[model samples]
Structure formats: C-alpha cells, structure tokens
Target: MERDRNLMRDILLTLALILAIDAVVVGVFALLAYPWLTFVHAPIAAVVGTTAAPVARWLVVFLPVLALFVWAQLRFTRQELLADVPAGDATRDTHPDLHARFVRLCKQADMQPPDLAVVDRDVPNSFAVGGVTNATVVVSEGLRDALSDDELDAVLAHELAHVKNRDATVMTLASFLPALVSDDRKILNVDGGANLLVWFVLTFVLYLLASPSLPGALFSVSSVVGFVTLVAISVLGGGIILGVLTAPVVLLSRRLSESREFVADRAGAVLVGDPSALVTALEKLSDRGFELPDTDARTHYTGVDGLCFLPYGLDDTDASTDEDTFTVETRSHPPTHERVANLRALVDEL
Candidate 1:
C-alpha cells in the first residue's frame, strides 16, 4: 500500500514538474517576444494593408518556440544522453544468458524487453532510458559477475520497473529545461543547447527585415543601433533570466527524483516477488566504481549517475578508502543506506 502511494505520488510529481518547467519555458519566450511584436508583424500588416491582432503576434512568436522545444526534447534524450556513456549493444547471440533472463523477466512483468547495452567494466550498475515502448537498459559487465542469478534478476527487474513506470522517460524529458541552466547536465545531455537561442534570434531578425516597424531604415544609424541593442538584450538577456527562473525547478527536481528512485526500488521489488533479493543485490554491489578497472571512477560515476541504478560511484572515499556516503540535497539519487532501508521495510511488509 505504501509503495503504491509512493508510485502514484511520483507519477503526479513527474507530470507536475514537466508542466512547470514547460510553463517557465513558454513564459520566458513570451516575455522576450512581446517587446518585438511590432517589428514582427509590421511587415505582414503592410502586406495585407491592416495590422495583425496582438494575439497574432504572440502566435507567430510562440509557434517556433514551441517547435524548437519539441525538437530539442526528442533529439536531446535520444541522441545526446548516451553520447558519452561507453556501452555496446547486447544481442542474444553474444549474451545468450543475459538476453534470455531479460526476456523472461519482461514476460513475467507483461512488458516487452528493451534493448540492452553492456559496458565492459567491473562496476555493478544498470539504468534505463527512453519510454516503455522505446527503452534501452544498460548493464555493466561487473554487475553480471558480482551478483547471483536471483540477484541479477532482481537488478534487471529494477531497471525493467523503471521502464514499466516510464520514469526514465519522464526524467530524461524533465532534464531538458534544467539542462539549459545546468553546466554539468549540459555536458552530458545537450550537445549544443544554442539551438533554441539561435533559432529565436534568427526568427526575430528575419521579421525585422520582412517589414520595417520604423520609417527611417532597417539599418538606420542612431535609432537602428538602439533598436538592435534592445533586441539583443531582450533575446540574450532572456536566457540569463530564464536560467534564474529554472534554478528553483532544478532544486525541486532533487526531491522528486529521489522519490522516483525509491519508487523504482519498491516497484522493482514487487515486479520480481523478491524484495530481499534487491536488498541483497544493492548491499553486495555497494562497493561499485571503487578500484574500477577502466577510466577515472569519479568522472564516470557522476557522468552516468543520473541514469545509473544507484549513485554508487558519485561519492568520495575517506582515508580508509571507504565511500564517504556524504551527500547533498541537490543529489538526484538518495543515499545507498536509505535505499537499502526502504527495501528492507518492503521485505518486512511481505
């Protein structure tokens, strides 16, 4: 019952956050575009011999902004999110056992199997991306080696739970707005975020020349320079201002993300009918990323932390070489102990 409540709460929260961030995006565009509406519609007005309605100007401005957002959302998650993570596709020919296990689990869960990406590392971690219908689950080589069959099934089921709930898609889509303001996320998810800014400036300038709002000239010296400067400030300055507005939503994401992680943990447990297996799996793999055989553990940890099953590698080690476990509220995942505790509680309920 508690798990169900958390699941529903997270679903609602995810939707609310998406709507909130989108609202902020539209609001920012409206604010920036309103000042230039006269220049935007002046050319069209002259062509038709009558001024366009005020709403017409906004519609003209909003259409492109909306289009850009939709395009960015799809391109960002599908292409850029996995651009940095090193993983190869898992095929039944190459990974017969793992592929079979995934297929069986999905059948039990009454969902289709998603594509799998295998990372050739000793780190035991996995995460899902995209939606239920179009999802990819990533697994580290070390993960299969570290856990027992049941435990591996538990971990895979956890990722499958994320796919089933569509939290992975929600999280990826949710990152779009926050990524605009976040440098760390930009590095991973957004290859060149200026697509919107570039498109916005292009549309704004094109209309400026399509028909002149002022009588002198499109390139008039004194007044033209001032008008150009205003346009620059309105468009460029809006980005800086919108970044400030999104800061609060970014903070809100921390809590909502943590909730979703917990829900995935519980849901993954329910999916497999073995909450204790997940608990054991998480505890055994807690030491992941330490003494990693490949790249810098810290960099890789933070790089995939958002999409990883656990935030195991995102922490610092103490002098004794133990994970610090220290975390800030801004972190997208809850602490390891908290996840284990939640799972343990679910076990008790069963």
Candidate 2:
C-alpha cells in the first residue's frame, strides 16, 4: 500500500515536469512565429491589396491540411495503442495447464482472465495488454520451453498481478499523454507539405486580419501596431495553450509508468507463493540472448521485455581477447543481479 502511494507521488511529479516543458516550448514558438509571421506578411499584403478578406477564410484552408496530417499520424500509431490478441486454441493448451491454474488464481484474486497469446519466437518474454475488460497476456514460445513448471507459474502469476492491479490501464493512460504531445509536435513540425501549407494559409489569415480597418474608422498610426500585436498574441496564445494543456499529461504518464512497474513487481511476487522463482527467472532471462528482429517504426519496445526475470546485458565478446575473457555493462532492463538480490531480500520478509 505504501509502495502504491509512492508510485502515485512519482507519477504526479513526472506530469508536472512534462507540463513545464510544454509551456516553455509553446511560449518560445509563439514569440518567434508571431513576429516573423507579421514582419514578412505585412509588406506582401501592402503590395497584393487582396488582404481585405476575413481570417476565417484562411482558417478554412488550414483545417483540411491539418486534418490530413492528423489522419496519417493516427494511422501509424494506432497499432501500439491497441493489439490484436490471437485466440488461445490447441497450441496454448499445450502449456502444461498453467493457463487453467492461472485463470483459477485470477478468479480467486477477483481479476479478469487476460487475453492470452503466444508468439513463436526464441526470446523468453511475456507482456499483458488491455484494461480491466480488454486485457490480455502474451508469452513467448521460448519462455514456455525455458522455465520449470513452477517458474512458469510464477511468471504467469506475475502477469496476472499486472492485471489485478489495473497496471494495464495505468500504463496505457500514462503513455497516452506523451503520445498526444508527440503527435501534436509532429503535426506542427512534420514537413509533409502540411507545415508549409499551414504557414502560407496562416500568413494569409494574418494579412486579412491586419488589412481591415473597423467600419467607418479612418486608418491611423496605431492600426499597423495594433495588427502586429494581434498577430503576436494569437500565435503566442496558440503555443501556450498547446503546451499548458499537454505537458503535465505526458509527464504524469511517464512517472506513472515507472511507479506501476515497481508496484506490479511487488504484487506479482505476492500472487505466486515465492519471489525466488521470479528472481531466478529474471536471472536466466537476462543472461540468455533476448534480441528481437527490428521492424521500422514498430521498434518501440513494449510488454514483458521490460519485466522479464533476466539480467539484461549486452553480449561482450572480442576476437582479439581470450575466449574466456569478456565484459558486459549497460543494459536497457534494470540489472538482473540487483533485482534478484532485492527480491531475495523481499522473499526473506515473506
């Protein structure tokens, strides 16, 4: 319970940081774009005299282009956001009946039976997805063959632990904020002709907004300055709005992810009788070769790859040195040895 509270606190702090960054970025863009947009466009309008139209006309042209950019982005990111779980048929039943046992345990724990999938890969890995209703679990073919029945049970229980704690929802929501912020940033900056087109349209809008003097009002010295101020305000206002709105959300998500990992690890240990199996599993998985094939943008890592009971390390081999001599450092997963040691301590308490 205390651990859960700590995780919540950390997630909050992370969100605060994300929000701060968002504000700064939006504020800076507003300043630069506001002035450059006005300075360049005011002269063009003076020459063209077509600037009498309302800014709304320019916004109409901008909307479709922005919509296309957003459409393409969602098409790309939708996969990571959702996964298609393979139905557990005969092949899944071959896994020594751990599935049935796990489902029973989940029932006892009052958790849902997570959608189960098994990938035919050599890497020992597993991961869970979905929230309470949509959740599913996946294990690698390699993991099934690698562990003893007890260890496998422990692994399965760990995943169920994730489901029980509602960690799936926590992680998903945590990721969503960053995904949104990233998507927005991409929308604004991506050069699929959209940014250029939007800028052109926005410039036209600014010109229109500047060109019109109030009805029956004579043009005066202040009109030009007033137009410039309005343009600056709009640009800056847009950026600030985006940053202030999105930044905290992203930061909160990341912090939640880290905390949830810790909570899941602890809860997983409790679901199974002993933490030692998890400790051992982590050790074995980390030492074993665990690389997966690369696929373009899909390379963003997810699932049990982060949670496996393994001492994750790079293969340190050298032709020039003796066959027995090697050194490995720097790992994406937390050091397995440290994790095992910690788990052992945790087990002793149990």
Candidate 3:
C-alpha cells in the first residue's frame, strides 16, 4: 500500500508538471504572437473590415506550432527506436538460455515478450525503448558477461517493467518541450548566436511585410541594419525570459524522472519476486564502472538516460567522489545506495 501511494503521488506530480510546462509553452507562444497580431494583422483587418482576421491570426500562430510538436514527437520516437537496434546479430540462437529466461519472465509478468536487442558496447547497462505494443529491450554485451543468470534476469525484469508501465510513451511526451528548447539552445550555441538573430530578423521582416502601415521605402539599407539589431536584442531578451520561466519546469521533470526509476525498481522486483537480485545486479553494474562510448553518449541528451537502469555518470566510486555536492544537484537517478536500500527494505517487507 505504501508503494502504491508513492506511485500515485509521483504520477500526479508528473502530470501536474507536464501541464504546467505546457501552459508555459503556450503562454510564451501567445506572447510572441501578440505583437504580430496587434501590429501586423489587426490594423490591416480594421482597414479591410474582415471578420476572418481573428481566425487567420489563430491559424497563423498555432498551426505551425502544433505541427512542429507532432513532428518532433514522431522524430524523437523514431530516433529512440533506431538507437535500440542491435549493432550485431542478437537472435535467440546466439543465446538460447538468455532468450528462454526472458520468455519465462515475460510470462510471469503476464505480458508479451518484447523484442530483445544486444548492444555491442562493453558498457554494462540496459534501457527500454518504444511503447507498450512495440517495446524493445536493449542490453549491452558487458551486461551479459558480468552477471549470473539471476542478476541478468533481474535486469531484464526492470527494463520489461518500464515497458509494461508504458514509461517510454509517457516520458517521450513529457520531455518533448524540454528537448525542443534544449535543441534550439544547442543550435544557437553552434551557430555562434547567429541562428537566433537570423530567426528573429526573419520573423520581424515577415511581420513588417504583412503590415499595411509599414511602407517598403522605410526598408532602406540603414533602416534594415537598425531593424536587425533591434530584433537581435528582442530575441535575446525573450530567450532569457523564457529560460527563467521554464527552468523550474525542467527541474521538476528531472525529479519526476528520478521518481520513475524508483517505481520501476519496485515493479521489477515484484515481477521477479526477488528484490535482492536487482539490488545485486545494480551493485555489480556500478562496481564495473561501465560507460557508454562518445557516439552513444549523444542519446542521453535526447532523454534516453532516464530509461537506463542506472544514471549515466554513476559508478561505485561516485559515492566517494569529491563532486558529491554537484552530483546530488544534477544527477538524474537517485543515489544508488538509496535505491539499493529501498529495495532491501522492500525485501524485508516481502
């Protein structure tokens, strides 16, 4: 009952956080559209006496935003699926015993067995991808070599729990806005700040062209230069404001992510009927000090880190590291010792 209550509380908090982030995104877009409507469309509508102006403005402002959101979600989901594809042949024939164990675990949990992929990396880590009907479990080669059958089964059970809980879909949708903003920030940094400046200038020019009050003669060389400067300042100011507003939402999302890890651990333990197996598995993985290669590390920025069995940077020695203060603030997963302790507590109750 306590576990159920914690799950319910986390779910409610996550939902509320997502809603709050959605509200902020909508509010920011509306603010951006206000100037365009007031200066560009409204005056033209007043002169032409058109009732369709409001509808037109709404479509102009919202249609592309909605389309972009849909496109982003699909694109990221595809990327996640692609990321999980086994780099080498990972068939039942390659490891019959492991396959049999996976099948048995799936049956025990009363769910269809998800496709399993073996990552060629030596990192002892695992993550779940896709949604309920299309879920895939990706395990690393190092993981297969490092653990006994019981420990490996526990790890698989954890990833499968993520699948059964539909965490992939929920996390993907919840993370869409943060990913979009984070990508934009990356682009801006890569382009030496020119991307944002160019975007703002283009937006302003488009608005000016649409406005009947602005004449083409005012678009002189000097005027154009001044307008670009003004747009750059406005864009910078808006970016700062948006960052301030969304920072808390981003932190909240991370907290929700950490909570999901605990929930998955409990669910996985229950599915396997052995919390100690998972605790042992976690300790083994941590002690090995496994790390993903640079190429694979890129996926973590895209939100896949949240789905991993352990937080990306954690190792056995992290507990003794000097960066404990920094780790406590920014680490996505809860401390390994705490998670293991929680599992041991659950074991006691069982």
Instruction: Name the best candidate (by TM-score).
Output: 1
Could you give candidate 1's per-residue lDDT for residues 267-346 as a string of tens digits? 78888899999998888887654553343322223445667786653223321332443222233777778999989888
Q: Write out the backbone clash pairs for model 1.
A: none
Q: What is the TM-score of candidate 2?
A: 0.54
lDDT of 3 by residue, 1-350 (tens): 67779776977777687767666665566555544444547654775557877666655666676666555665666345444344443568997777888899999999998777777766677888775358777787878888988888888998898888877766666666665555522323436468778877877776575343333456666656654554565577667766665566567667776777788898889988999999999888767744343432212332344567865521212123233221112116777888899899999999
lDDT of 3 at 181: 56
Local accuracy of candidate 2 as per-residue lDDT tens digits, 13-99: 764565455444434443434333333444545655446422433333345434543344344332443333232422345754756
Using lDDT, give the best candidate's number: 1
Compared with the true structure, all predictions reach lDDT values of 0.70, 0.53, 0.67
Model 3, TM vs. native:
0.73
Candidate 1 weakest lDDT stretch, 10 residues: 313-322
TM-score of each: 0.80, 0.54, 0.73
lDDT rank order: 1, 3, 2
